[model samples]
Target: MALAATVAGAPVHAQDSDWLSYRDAYRGMVAFEKYGKPKQFLQQHYQVGARDGSPLPVDFRLALSGKTMQLNLPLDAVGRAVFPLLKAAYDENAVLTVNRKLGAYVFRPRISIVVRPDGVYEGAELRAACEQALDFQRTVNAAGYRDKHCVGVRFTFAKKPDADVRWKGGAPLPAVPGPAFPDEAGNAYSVVTVRFDAATDKGQVVSQNAPLAVSPVFE
Candidate 1:
């Protein structure tokens, strides 16, 4: 599988059962959900295009503060890495717009993480990696998302290897790379499987998803 090419530490074949669960769990979490009300400061629509104006699929990473959420849409691979950082920064400056009449804040925190080239691979490790990345992005951004005084709170993504990597409590194939393709939306994406480790944060890292939008895409 494509994930094997990305995992650098272990041999491809190691565990089995564990990898299977990982694959099943990962696939179960791909649907999109509405988060909350939108903000006026964020862009209404993000334009995701390649350097040459080619339409690229956009994957998003999100971070949330008390009532504010930050959305990031990376236009390229390099931008993908920096997208989380940008969300962190934006969440820092977001102010709560309160509504006296409603006795509540006018803005509701919400974010959506999407990727182009959907279903590039089918396995446990890739799903775990995506979840981990999302969790980290959300937690780190939370520092800025919430009030400046917010403290003593910690966030982390769960660490679990893909099913192909573990079976019957034994490690299976290290990780395999999978086919590359674009989703019906016409965007390219790739999936890689990797073992999950709380230490060094290595094992499985896949190609970044398309740009993600944290806007109130819903009403």
Candidate 2:
């Protein structure tokens, strides 16, 4: 008799736990506490363009339970190196899935912003201008994002726009802030808001999220 090697179901190459933790693939500066491992992976594979220091906060889910990613890189040998680190990040018995198109996993719906310029548009007028754009009919399809129509609203201005603008915007835009806008002084930059679990497919004003202002004082 000859012994044969075989898998029980469809030659399963990998296994993942029944429950996978949800993750957001943010484009902007995200806190390393909840997404520590994923950030580490991005830092290690710096070429992936995941951490380009862009103001546009993109969001998506990680292949693993918000910790690691698995890939069967037959053609891309370099990708294989990232596996061990990703695998170890999760639990010993925690099942993981192999995501081939890891890049696609990151979805940037659209970086819609109120171009509140740096010059005269610094304060109230900036907010007024942003209001026009926000009030416009630019729809954002948040299918790729876990939260439907949850937007990472960015208010571009040399100075803070009316805080009231943070609570404004439509269903598709979800003009919600990422975090609380800091009162710290520096060169002008955009304010990003973190909006979670918005229940609309279009930009609906989510007034709850606070804004986080990012000032770039490049030396």
* Best-matching candidate per TM-score: 2
Q: How does each model score on lDDT?
A: 0.24, 0.25
Give each model a TM-score.
0.18, 0.20
Alpha-carbon RMSD to native, per candidate? 20.7, 18.1
Candidate 1 regions with alpha-carbon error over 4 angstroms: 1-74, 77-187, 197-219
Candidate 2 structure, TM-score to reference: 0.20
Candidate 2 deviation (Cα RMSD): 18.1
